[model samples]
Target: MPETGYMAAAVAVCTAITWALRALPFAVLSRLRQSPLAAYLDTAMPAGIMVILAAYTLRGADWGAASSAGPTALALAVTVGVHLWLRNAVVSILAGTAACIALTALAP
Candidate 1:
């Protein structure tokens, strides 16, 4: 385990890098508003975000294991049902989490 001070410094460094990666483009583009690069970035950002989200979501997926199927399917069903019924973020999230926990606990 990392020492407390080392962990804090590592977290601070990671946070700084993340912030700089996100902010640098905007800062540069603001100064070059009329550039083609700016227009390209604006149009490409949504697609980039979608690809990143898809990659993140599928990163840990293990299709070879049947163990993940039941709980994941149940949680997905719960999430869809809750969103359809409540249309509220907090309620949907809580309901989904609760349903997942209950289903996981009951699973063989």
Candidate 2:
């Protein structure tokens, strides 16, 4: 068994290493806060993510079909309109999703 002083020293060193690992990100993040790349991503990522999501969601739709096309197009319109009107993501997504589901279900 190790001596008590040796055990305590080992524990202290481990605790310091763990603390430094945990603190590393916060230190890096403070540096990132002033970075130009971070600044651009802050503004661009939201719109880019939205576009990627929209594309992924719509890509599987059978848009050439008359029945599927109308509901899909109208759903997109409703989504854009609601987002423009309310400026709310949850309500807009819900309204758009509801419109798409209801319209597709009601379609012949």
Candidate 3:
């Protein structure tokens, strides 16, 4: 059986370790905020992520069939157009998603 003091000390050590782990990322990120690489990533990551998402979304489409591919193509177009017109990622994504749902529902 552990003593009460030993148990208290163990709990304190665990709490400190947990706090440090949670805080480490913010500490490192605060330091990295001034780095050129972080700046570049801040600018580049959105476009890169959008491209990757677009590719992933369309990769499984059956290009030879209009019925299968039409909704996806229209959704992508709407997404791009909305993003370009509104310059808002959230609105673009929502509009594209709504377009896709409507198109799919209307499809036979």
What's each prediction's clash count?
A: 0, 0, 0
lDDT of 3 by residue, 34-94 (tens): 9999999999899999789868757745553344577878988999999999999999999
Better of 1 and 2 by TM-score: 1
Could you tell me the TM-score of candidate 3? 0.48
Q: What local lDDT does model 1 show for residue 23?
A: 88
Candidate 3 residue runs with Cα over 4 Å from true position: 1-49, 60-67
Error of 1 at 83 (Å): 0.7
lDDT (tens digit, per residue) of candidate 2 on 1-108: 899999999999999999998988896687788899989998989999988988776775645434477888898899999999999999998998899889989998
Instruction: Encode model 1's per-residue lDDT on 1-108: one tens digit a residue.
Output: 889999999999999999999988886668787889878887989989976884565455565433355776777678779889889978887887788677767888
The 10-residue segment with the lowest total lDDT in model 3: 59-68
- Once model 3 is optimally superposed onto the true structure by TM-score, how far is the C-alpha of residue 80 displaced, in angstroms? 0.8
**Candidate 2 lDDT for residue 103:** 98
TM-score of model number 2: 0.55
RMSD of 1: 4.5
> What TM-score, to 2 decimals, does candidate 1 have?
0.65
For candidate 2, list the clashing residue pairs, or say none.
none
**Between prediction 2 and prediction 3, which has the larger TM-score?**
2
